[model samples]
Target: MALKILSGCINCDMCEPECPNQAISMGEKIYEINPDLCTECVGFYDKPTCISVCPIDVIITDPAHIESKESLLEKFKHLVNTDRI
Candidate 1:
């Protein structure tokens, strides 16, 4: 599944750099995760790097974009092949 950043973000700038797919970015008030670009690190890591680096533990699975592991892997492959990673 894709991940989403909750509202408690301090904008510490930790998660943004950790995201392998470049899915995290500065939103109007806090860091945001783009579901379309998020694969939960399926292709780059065993776990999500952004979640590991986030200090406040505000990152969580996006219920709106629920996806299976195999689906996430396919998305990762697509990002890599399309040079969007």
Candidate 2:
């Protein structure tokens, strides 16, 4: 599943660089995660790198785009395979 930044975000630049999928980006008000690119670090790390680095704990899973581990893994695999072609 994709993670969403809450309203309390401090506009900190910490989370974006930590994303293995390179999914986080600066939004108009705060940082945003690209659901199409966000794999929740399923293939790269044990935990979500953004969540682990977020100092204020404002990151949470997107309920609207909820997904399973298997789906995320599949997404990651697709991304990896796509990068080759």
What Cα-based lDDT does every candidate model obtain? Answer: 0.93, 0.93
Tens-place lDDT per residue, model 2, 1-85, is: 8999998999889999999888999998999999999999999999998999999999999998999999999999998998889
Candidate 1 ranges with C-alpha deviation above 4 Å: none
Which ranges of candidate 2 are over 4 A from the true structure? none
Question: Relative to the unseen true structure, what is the C-alpha lDDT of residue 51 in candidate 2, on a scale of 0 to 100?
Answer: 94
| Minimal lDDT window, size 10, model 1 | 76-85
Across 1-85, the per-residue lDDT of candidate 1 in tens digits comes to 8899999999999999999889999999999999999999998999999989988899999999999999999998999999954
lDDT for residue 14 in candidate 2, whole number 0-100 = 98
At residue 20, candidate 2 shows an lDDT of 82
